[model samples]
Target: MFNVSDGVPAGGEPVAVTFAAVFVALFVAHQVGDHWIQTQHQASHKGDAGWSGRWACVKHVLTYCATAMVSLAGLAAVTGWCPDGVPAVVGMAVSGVSHFVIDRRWPLRWLADRLGKCPDWLERGGGLYALDQSAHIGFLFIAALVMAS
Candidate 1:
């Protein structure tokens, strides 16, 4: 949960600006983590049906979170902005859990199916990745808002 606060913190960045920056940081980190940082093995296998797939997803998520942490810290250092501890932790947990759930892959497919998206479309093309990344971005918005608070 986010606590209400003045738009500007000690660093003097308004909440709107901070939220935008935090969202950008999270989004960029997400792209890098999911694309560049993720191992080919993880990408290929994380969605498989087994403990192995679970392990790969877990490993990928760990690195993804690390990249996000580094990105946020770097942003803070460069901008002199700081997030509160509780909200920051809550936000990260939210983001991390959401990422893990989404990367498990089946959840998104199931969701897409339930929502009436074509199953073959998800299987054959960029549909799954699009849904996956969009979910991540949606959660990132929540994370950024909480952190900015």
Candidate 2:
């Protein structure tokens, strides 16, 4: 939805600026949704195998995805940089599913257990936490690209 004439590539696509703007907007939304909207209960109990934990995690992911989708849509409306129709939906689905899988904490625990050792800095989950956030950001980038596609 960006200005079609400005910085049109040889392929006649929108300028890179539009992509960058969408990426930044989505990233900000991700930070707010993951950190602010997520409840402590969902954070604490999501890894459990029980139904309550599963539901908590599901609820968290739903809100998180909604936040990202809304932010992306708003950005599109503001900047006139909307991508193809399916990309936004595909991006959100991928982002949300990946977020859910990573936040479940099973992979982190598996890595920790298999590593068989941890330095002091890595002891209190700094390592896993960083990895988790990194993965989320990576997914967000992909989602942004999909949305800008």
Candidate 3:
């Protein structure tokens, strides 16, 4: 877990500013890793079956999680304060697994198809991408909370 200490008087409760900073850091990490760091092959092949797709997704998520960890480390170095616990690890595990599942797109696609008469947007690949990213952002928030807690 990433520890984000805000130089607050140790032994006392943390300040809101610390959490806010961590949240911003994690969010930035998400954007950087998910968009900038990810390669075309990783983006397009994450949902493939067998080892190829699974490996791609794993690599992507590792980079994504590393981004978040580095961001938190940066914040800690600069602020000299951070949350103290395993929250970040737990959060990352949850987020990573969630990301892997969502990126697969099959489950969501199945649901959309089952619900028949779905909106055109929901049926498009772009919509799935949007949904996948939204889920990631949501998990990022959770990760931040884990760090802040």
Judging by TM-score against the true structure, name the best candidate.
Answer: 1
Clashing pairs in 2: 1-80, 1-82, 2-80
Root-mean-square deviation per candidate: 2.4, 3.5, 3.6
Error of 1 at 3 (Å): 11
Clashes of 2: 3
All candidates' TM-scores? 0.91, 0.81, 0.81
Q: Positional deviation of 66 in candidate 1, in angstroms?
A: 0.4
Off by over 4 Å in 2: 1-15, 111-120
The residue ranges of model 1 lying beyond 4 angstroms of the native Cα positions read 1-8
lDDT (CA) per prediction: 0.87, 0.77, 0.76
What is the alpha-carbon lDDT for the whole of candidate 3?
Answer: 0.76
Q: Which residue ranges in model 3 land beyond 4 Å of their true spot?
A: 1-15, 111-119, 123-125
Q: Residue 87, candidate 2: how far off, in angstroms?
A: 0.7
lDDT of 2 at 48: 82
Q: Candidate 2 lDDT, tens digit per residue, 20-130?
A: 776788788889898999999988988888788788889999999888878877876775555666776787887888888888888766765687736454557587777
lDDT score at residue 74, model 2, on the 0-100 scale? 86
